[model samples]
Target: MAGKAPYIVPVGPIHPALKEPVHIELTVVGEEVISADFTPGQTHRGIEWMGLSRNPVQIVHLTDRICGICGVTHSLAFARAVEQIADITVPERGDYVRTIIAEFERIQSHLLWAGVAAHELGFDTLFYLAWRVREEAMDAIEVITGNRVNYDIIQIGGTRRDITEDQYDKIRKCLNTYKDLFSKLKKLFLEDAVIKSRCVGTGLLSFETAMAYSAVGPTSRASGVTADLRVDYPYCAYGDLDIKPIMPTIYGSDVNGDTYDRIVVRIFEVAQSVEIIETCLDNMPPGPVIWEEKVAKILSTCKKASGEAVGRHEAPRGEAVHYVAMDGAEAPISWKVKASSYSNLHVWPIILKGAQLADIPVIVASVDPCLSCTDRVAVTDNGSTKIFTKEQLAKMSYEKSRRMMQ
Candidate 1:
C-alpha cells in the first residue's frame, strides 16, 4: 500500500453527472484522491465577444442565453450596468419585481442542484421528488414572466413586464405549497441515514479556505462565511426586506462546511426566498415597471451616455458581475462578465484532496456549478495569442455559417 503509485483519472468533457462539459483531472492513489484540478473552457460560445456588435437593448436579451437556469441573472446584471451609465432610475415597482424574480430563480436553482446531488449519490427517489417539487417554482416564474426559461423580462432602464394584481394570487398559492412542504424536505434531505452517512464529513471546505478562495452563495455560507451580497450589499427590494445569510447553524448544527452543510444551507435558503417574495408582494409600490417604455428613447439615452459602471447581483450560485463601458455609441465599447462559479471553482483542488473516488460526483455537484456561464475562451494560433476584433469574429462566424450551408 505504501508503494502504490498515484495515477491521473480524468472525468468529463462529457459525463452523466456533469450537466456541462468540464474536464476534471484527479490524481489518485488507489481509491483516495491525492490531488485534483479542472479545466472549464470547453463549452465557451464567445457570448461577451458577440455583445460587442450589439446595442445595449439587443445585448440584454442575449444575456438571457448565458445560462438556461439563471434566466434573469445575466440580463439583470447587464441592464443594471447600462442603467447606471445612462443615469436611468428604475421605478420603485420595477425594483420590487426584480427582487421577486431573483428570489424565484434562487428557489428553482437550489432545488435543481439538490436533485442533481441526490442523483449523484444514487438516491433516485429523492432526485425525482426534488425535481417534482421544483416544478412549482418554475410555474411561478412562468406565471410572472410568461416563460419558464430564458425569461426576457429585464430591460435597460427596468423590467419589460409588470406583475399585475391578478397574477399575485397564483404566485402566493405556489409559495403556500412550498411553506407546507418545507418540513418534509428538511426531513428527507437532512435526516435520512444514507445522505447523512455519505455527506456528513466529506468534501470539507474550512471557513478560512472558503474566504481565502473567495467562495460565494451557499458554498461559502455553509462554511459560516457571512458573505451574501444580498445581505452585505443590498440591491433592488432586498434593501427593504430583512434578509440574512443562511448558515448550517440555522439547521441547528455547527458549521461543518461539508457536503451536508451545503445541502442544509440551500434547503433553508428556499424558505428564505419564499419569505422575500411574499414580502415584496405585500408591499410592492405602485409605478411603471420600466423607466422608458419606448425602445427608441431608451436607445437614445444609452447612445448619449458616456461612462463606465459595474453591475453586481447575488445569483443562485453567488455574486455575478457585469462590467460595461460606453462612449456615445449604440454599443458598449467594453463588456465583461464574472459568473459566480468563477470564484468557487478554484477550491476544487483543496476540497478534493484525500476524498474517496466514489464521493467525487457528489462533491463536485455540491458546488452547484454552471460552467457554461463561467467559461471564456482565449484563441491562440501557432503558439502566439490571437485576439479577434468584432469585425474579424463576425466575418469568421459568417464564413462558418456559409460552410455549414454548403
Candidate 2:
C-alpha cells in the first residue's frame, strides 16, 4: 500500500461526465480522489469581445445567446446596466414583467439541472420525469415571450413584450401545475434511497470553504451562505417582493453542504420562484412595459451616455453581474460579464477532493456549472493556447490600461 503509485485521471475537453467542455485533472489513489483541478476556458465564445463592437441595444440580443437555459438572465443584466448609464427608469409594469419571466427562467433552469443530475446518478426514469415537468415552464415562457429558447424579450430600458390579461390565465395554469407537481418532485428527488445514498455525504463543501471560494446561488445557499441578490441587493421588482434565500435547512435538516444539500436548495428554490411569480402577477401594475418604445431613441440615449455602472440580477444559478462603461460612442468602451458559474466553479477542486471516482459525475453536475456563460477570455498566440498566471494577467491588464490611456 505504501508503494502504490498515484494515477492521474483526465476527464474531458469532451467526456461523457461533463455536459460542457472542461478538462478536469484528478489525482487519485485507487478509487478516492487525492486532489482535483479543472480548466474552464475550453468553450470560450468571446461574447464580450463581440459586444465591444455593438451598441447596447444590439448587445442586448447578444446577451440572450450567453446561456441557453437562462434566456432572460444575461439580457436583463445587460439591459439594466445600459439603463443605468442612460438614466432610463423602467416602468413599474416593466419591472413586474422582468421579475415574472426571470422567475420562470429559474424554474426551468433548476429542473433541467435536476434532470442532468439525475442522469449523472444513473436515475434515467427520474431524469425523464424532471425534463418532462420542465416543459410546462417552457410552454409558459413561450406563451409570454413567443419563444421556447432565447426569448428576446428584454430591451435596453424595459421588455419587448407585455403580459396581457389574456395571457394571465395561461401563466396561472402553468403555476398551478407546478404547485401540484412540487411535492412529488421533492419526494422523488429527496426521499429516494439511491439519491440519498449517493449524494447525502458526498462532495461536502463547508460554509467556510464555500465563502472562501466566493460561491454563489444554490452552491453557496447549500453551504448556508445567505447571499441572494434578491434579498441582499434587490433589483427589478425584487425590492417589492418578500423573498429570502433558500437554504437546505428548509428541508428540516442541518446544513451538510454536500451534493444533496445543493439538490435541496435548488428544488425548494423552484417553489420559491413559483411564489414570486404569483405575487408579481397578483400585484400587477398597469402601465407600459417599455420606457422608450423607439429602438432608435434608446440607441441615441445610449450613444449620449458617458458613465459606468454595474447591473446585478439574481439569476437562476446565482448573482449575475454586467459592468458597462460608455463614452458617447455607438458601442460601450467596456462591457464585462460575470456569470454566477464563474464564482461557483472555484469550489470544484475543494468539493471533488476526497470524493470517490464513481461520484465525480454527479458531484460535478451538482454545481450546475454553465461554462459557456462563465468563460470570457481565452488567449491563443499563433494557434497555440496560453495559460497565464495571476501575476502575468495583472501586469498585462496594467499595460493594456496604459496603452488605452495613451
Candidate 3:
C-alpha cells in the first residue's frame, strides 16, 4: 500500500469490457483500496421489459441481442423457457446442434478473454497470439451460421440451421487447430513467469466466498466450486454428454480463485468446449433441425401457450437464466433475465478488498463481467465522483511494476 491519497476515488465509469460500462467507487488507503462499490446498468437495453410486450417468436430475436459473445446462449435460454411453457420437445438432433453451437461460442469467448487477460498484464505478444488463434473459431462459426457473432441459429423448438457435413469438417479443422496449440497455450498461460506474478495471488476469491456469493461458471470453478449449469441443471444435450467443470487445482493452484486461476480455468474450458463439440457432432442423429410444423403456426401456438418456466444456459461467462410466464396471449405475461454478471457482481467487493489500484483492472476482468446483460443503475443528483485518467492508471501500474522490479 502506498500513502493515503484521495478519500474516495472512482476507478471506472468506462472500461475495456466493451458494451459493459460500469462505475466503481473505491475508498483507498494509499494505493490499496480499502472498500469499493460499483454501479452497473449503464448498458441497459430493457430487453426483458421489451420481451414481455412481444410474442415468443419475436422475443427470440430480442434475447439474441442481449450480448454478442453469448447471444446464442441467451436465445437458447429463452427458447428453453418458451419450450418448457409450451411443453415442447426438441428432437435429439436439435439438442445436439444447440450444444455444438454453444460450445463453439464458448471456445471463441474464452480465447477473447485469454487475450484480454494477457493484455492486462502488459504481455502484448501473448495477447496477439491468443486472438490470432481465435480467428479460426470465428471462421468455423461463420461457415455454419453465416454470421460471426449473432448466429441466430437456436429457435424456440429447434435450430433454424443444420450442421451440414462440410461445416462439420470445417469445425473439426478449427478444433484441431486449437488442439495443436493446446500445449503451447498451456505452457504460455500457465507457466509464464510474468503471468504467474501478476495473476497467481491476485484477486483471490475462496470457494466459500464464491458459493456465498452464488458465483457460477469459471469464476467459481477457478475457486474449486464445481458449479456449472450444464452439469447441475442438465439442460439441452448436456445431460447426454459427460460434462466436467474445470478447476484450477489441476495446475497446483490452491483453489484460491485468483485472476491466474480464472485464466487457467477459462483456457481449460476452451479445451473442454472443443471436446464437447466433437462429441455432439459425432453423436448427432439424422433429422430435420427445426420443428417445421411448430414454426408454420408459431404465433398461434405461443398465443395459446399459458404457463411459467425457467430456462438456463451455460453461457461463455457463466449461467444465463430466464424466467418466463405466458398468459395464453401473443406476449409473455412476465419475463426476467438474470445474466451471469448479476451473480458475479456480489463477489467483487470481497476480491477487491485490500487490492492495489494497479490490480483493479485485473480483478474486475477476472470475473469476465458482462454488464450489458446484468446491470443496475444508482442515480444521485449532482453526484461528485472522482475520475482517473488512463495516464494516471497506467502510471500507477508502471510504478508498481518498477517497484516490484526494484
Candidate 4:
C-alpha cells in the first residue's frame, strides 16, 4: 500500500443501489477519489440507427424507447426533425397541445426525481408523500393519451388526438391540488436542515465547469449556467408562454452550485411547468390534432428534393437533439439522437470524487441522470469487493437514526 497505483472502483451496470444501468469508474487514493471514468455505453441499443431504415411512420414509436421517463421529448425531437425535413408546418393549436404535453412530462419527471432523491438520502417519508402526489400527473397522462409512461401520441405532422374540455378541466384540478402539496414539499426539501446539511455544500460544480462539460437542465442551471432551451432558445409554443427559467437560490439565497442547489432548481421548476401548462390550457384553440391529408401531400412534395433537418427539445434531464437525413423517400436515410443524459452524466466523477461513499446515491440522483440512454461497467480494486443488499443499506440508515436518538 506504500507506492501503489490508486484503486479504481466501478460503481454500476446492474449494481447501483439506487439508479439505472450506467457504470461509473472512480480512482481513489486512500479515501479520497482522485479521478473518475464514466462509461455509459453498456445499454446502447442503436434505437436511433434503426430509425434510418424504418419508414417515417415507424420512427415515432422507436423514439419512445430511448428514455421511458422522457419519451415525449424524444418523439417530439424526431417529429420536429421530420417536419423540418419535409417543410411541414404544424398548426398553432397543434403547437400549444405539444407544449402542454411536454410541460406535463416535465412536472411528473421532476417530482419523480425529487422523490427518488429524498429516498436515497434516507428521507423515506418525504419520498412516499411526494410520489403519492405525483400520481395525479400520471393519471392525467393516462386520461389524455391512454398511457402513462409512453404516450405514443405524437405523430409525424401533429398529435394523434386533441385535448378535450373535460381533459383540460381535470388537468386544472390536478394542478391546483399539486400547487398546495408542492408548497409544503418545497419547504421541507429546500429548507430542511438535515436535507441542506447533506446536499448544500456537496457536489459543487462551478458555472465554468458546467459549461465546459456541456451540462444541461437543472444540473447546469443549478450552477448558474444560463442554458435552458425553453427560455434561451424557444421552441414549439414555449415562445408563447411566459417562462423565466427558475434558477437555484431563488427561494432566498444566492446559488451555492451544489447538490442542494440542483435539488432546489428542480423543485421550483415543477411549479414553473405547472404554470406553463395552465397558460397553454387557457389559450387552447380548436383545430384538428393530426394533419391527415397534408402529410401525404407533404411527403409527395419532399420526394423531389434530398435534404436533412435537426430538431432540439428540452427534456426533463436536459436538451435532446435529433438529426435526420432524408433522401427524398418515405423514410429517413439516417437518424441520430443525442439525449440530454449523454452530456449531463459526464459531470458525475467531478462532482462525486470528494464526497463520502454513503452520499453517492444522493449526488447521482441530484442530476436526475437518465442511465437507460447510456449504460456500462468495469471494476478495478485490490481489496475485497463489498456488495450490500438493498435491505442492508436500509437497515444501516435506520440503525444510524436509532443511534442518533439514543
Candidate 5:
C-alpha cells in the first residue's frame, strides 16, 4: 500500500441522466471514495448583480427568476429589501397576503423536494404520489396568484391582487385537503421498512459539523441545529403565527444524521407550513390588500430613489439572504444574493464521506439543491422546460375568476 494511487472520477455539468448541471469530482480508492467535491458548473447566472443596476420596478421581475421553485420567496425578499430602504411600512393586509403567499410557496417547494428525494432513491411510485398531493398547493397558488411558478404578485409596497372572501374560502378548503394528504405521506416516509432501510444510517451529518458548515433548512435541522429564520427573524405575517421551528429528537437508537432524519424533518415541517397558512387564512383581516395610494405615489414619481437594506426569507431549501445596496439615485447600484443552498453545499463533503456510490443522488437531492435554470419547471435545458408567458398568467387569472362564478 506504500505507493498506491487514488482515482479521480469526473462527473459533469451535463451528465447523461441528471436533470440539472453539476460537476462532481470524486477521489476514490478502488470502490471506496476517499473524498468528493462539487461545483455549480455553468449554473450561476448573476441575476443578483443585475438587480443592482436595473430600476427598482424591473428588479422584482428579475428576482423572480432567481430560482424556479422559490420564485415567490425571491420576489418577497427583494420587495422587503426595497420597502425597507424606502422607509415604507406595508399595510396590514399586504402583510397578510405576503405571509399567505410565502407559506403556499413553502408547501409546494417542500412537497416537490420530497418527491425529488424519493425519485433519486429509485422510488418512482412515491415520487408520483407526493407530486399528486403537491398539485393541490400548486392549483391553490395558481388560483390566488394567476400563475403556478413566478407569481409576479408582489410589489414594493404591497401585493397586486386582493384575496376576496370567496377566494379565502377556496384557499382554506385546499389546505384542509392537503393536510390529510400530508399526514398519510408522513406515515409512509416514517414507518415504511424499505424506505427506512435505504435512508437510515446513510449520510450522517453531526450536529457540530452542521453548525460549522452553517447548514440551513431541514438539512441542518436533521442534525439538530436550531436555525430557522421564520422564528429567529420574523417577517411579514410570521410574527402573528407564533410558529416554532421543528427539530428532531433522539429516538431508540443513536441519533444518526442520515437521510431518514432529513426526510422526517421535512415531512414534519410540511405540516407546520400547512398549519401556518391555515392560521393566516383564518385570522386574515378585512382591508385593502395593498397600499394603493402609496404605490400610486411611488409609481407616478419618475425620480429615482434608493437605499441599502438586507432581506431574508425562509426558502424551502433554506434561509435565502438578499443584500440590496442602492445609490438613492437611479434604479439600483448593486444587489447580492446568498441562497441557503450556497451555504449548505459546504456540508456536502462532510455527509458524503463513507456514503455508498448508489446513495449519492439520494443524499444530494435530500438537501433540495436549487440548481436554477433560466426558466421554471416546464422549461428544461433540453428544450423541455415550459414557462408560461405573460399572456398565459393572465388567462390563468381569468380562469380562476370563472371558477368562483361556478
Candidate 6:
C-alpha cells in the first residue's frame, strides 16, 4: 500500500461541475492531491474576432456579453481604449455615472462570488444569505441602467444614462441596506465555524507566487499584493479617489492567501465599493452623458479613425484589459481581450497541489474562475468537446459546493 502509485484524474472539458468548461488533471495518491495541470478556453466565443468584424459601437455591446457579471468592466475597458485612439474626453457627468455603475457592478460581483464560495463550502444558507443581500445592489443597478446583468450603459465617450434626484434617493436607500448587512455578513464569513473550518487553511497561494503569476483583483489582494488597476492605472472616474487595495490583514487575517483570506478581501472590497459609490454620487456634475452621435454616425466616425491602444479595468475577478487596433475601417483591424481569470488561472497548480480531492471545487471557486470571460484567447486546444449549458454548469457548481459541506 505504501508503494502504490498515484493516479491521474481528469476533472473537466465536458464536466458539468464548472460554470465554464476547464479540464483540470490531478495527480493524486488516495484522496490527497500531489500535483495538478489545468487546461481552459473551452467556451471560446471568438469575441475578439467578433469585435474586429463589427464597428466599435457593436463591440461595446459585444464586450458586455463577455461575462454577464463583469460586463460593465469589459465595456468600460473597450470604451476607454477606443476613446484613447479617437482622442475623446468623457464629460464630468459621464465619468461619475461610469464610476457609480462600476462600483455597483463590483458590489454585485463580489456578493455573487461570496454566495458561490459559500455554496462551495456546502453552506447553502449563507449562499442564499449573500445573494439575498446582493439583490439590493442589483436593484440599484437596474434603476440606474434599466438592466441587471449587462448594464449596456458604458459607451465610447460616456454612459447611456444619468442618475436623477429620485433615483439617487432609491440608490441611497439600497446602499443603506447593503451597509447594514455587510457587517453581519462579514462576521459570518470570518467567524462562523463552518466557513472558517472549511476555508481558512485551504488553497494557500503565497504573495511571491501570486506576483509570479501576476494575479489581480481580490486574488492578489488576499495575498497582500496591492496591484489594483484602479490605483496603478486610473481610468473612468477611478481617478476621483485615492484607492487602497483591501487585504486579508485588514480583516484580522495574516496574508495567507487562502480561501478564507480571499473571502475576507472580498468582504472588505464590498465596503470600499459602497464608499466609492457614495463619493461619486456626491461629486457628480451635470453634463451630457454621451457624445451626441447616432449609431450610424458612430460607425462612420470609427471608419475614419486609425490607431492602437489598450484599456484596462479592475474587474471583480482581477484586471480585465483589451487591446484594440483600428485601420480606417468600420470594424476594428485587431482586438484582443484579456480577462482577469487569464492571469489568476496560473496560480491553480500551486494552490491545488496539497489540497484534498473534495477541496478541488473550493480552491477553484476561490479564484472565482470565469472561463467564459477568459475564453476569447489565443491558445489552441485540439481536445474533444461536450454540450454543457450555463444552467447545467451552475447546478453542478452548486451541487459540488453543497457536497463539500459533508
Query: Which candidate wins on TM-score?
Result: 1
RMSD of each: 1.4, 5.5, 9.7, 10.4, 9.3, 7.5
Q: How well is each residue in 1-406 modelled by candidate 1, as lDDT tens digits? A: 4999999999998999899999999999999999999988998898888798899999998999999999789999999898999999999899999999999999999999999999999999999999999999999999999999998999888898999999999999999999999999999999999999999999999999999999998999999999888889888888898888999999899999999999999999999999999999999999899999999999999999999999999999999999999999888899999999999999889889989999999999999999989998867788898888778978989999999999
Candidate 4 per-residue lDDT, tens place, 1-406, comes to 3676788777887773546776677777676667777666666664755566677767888888878899899999988988887777877778888888898899899989988999988999999988998899998888888899989978877888789987878888889987888879888898798998899888888898899999998899999987889988898898887778678757777877899999888888888888898888888877776666465665565554368888999999889898888887766777777888888887887898787766777887888888776442223378655566536755866898899999
Stretches off by above 4 angstroms in model 6 are 14-17, 376-406
TM-score, predicted candidate 6 vs. hidden true structure = 0.91
Q: Residue 52 of candidate 5: its Cα lDDT? A: 52
The per-model lDDT (C-alpha) reads 0.93, 0.93, 0.84, 0.81, 0.77, 0.86
Runs of candidate 4 with Cα error greater than 4 angstroms are 1-6, 293-305, 375-406
**Models ranked on TM-score:** 1, 2, 6, 3, 4, 5
Write the number of the candidate with greater lDDT, choosing between 3 and 6. 6
TM-scores of all candidate predictions against the true structure: 0.97, 0.93, 0.90, 0.88, 0.86, 0.91
Write out the backbone clash pairs for model 3.
3-30, 4-30, 41-376
Least accurate 10 contiguous residues by lDDT in model 5: 373-382
Which of the two, 2 or 6, has more TM-score?
Answer: 2
Q: For model 5, how does the per-residue alpha-carbon lDDT over 1-406 read when each residue is reduced to its tens digit?
A: 2466888877677774255787778786666567889767367564654555567667888888888888887888877887787776778888988888888888888888888887887788998998998999999999889999889988878898878777977888888897778658977778888888889988889989988888999898888877899899888888887777777663334455788888887887878888888888788888876665565465433124556888888888778877777665656666777777888877777777777777777777777777773211233576565677646855876898899999
**Candidate 2: lDDT over CA atoms?**
0.93
Q: C-alpha displacement of 330 in model 3, angstroms?
A: 0.2
Give the 10-residue window scoring lowest on summed lDDT in candidate 2: 388-397
Question: What TM-score would you give candidate 1 relative to the actual structure?
Answer: 0.97
Worst 10 residues of 4 by lDDT: 371-380
Q: Say which prediction, candidate 1 or candidate 5, comes out ahead on lDDT.
A: 1
Give the C-alpha lDDT of model 1.
0.93
Model 2 C-alpha lDDT per residue in residues 1-406, reported as the tens digit of each score: 3667899999998998788899999999888898999887877766887788898988998999999999699999999888988999999999999999999999999999999999999999999999999999999999999999999999988999999999999999999999999999999999999999999999999999988999999999999999999998888899998888999999999999999999999999999999999999999999899999999998899899999999989898999999999999999999999999999988999999999999999999999999999986777899998988656866887898899999
Query: Candidate 6 lDDT, tens digit per residue, 242-343?
Result: 778888878765788899899998898999999999998888887788775476665566678899999888888888889999888888888888889989
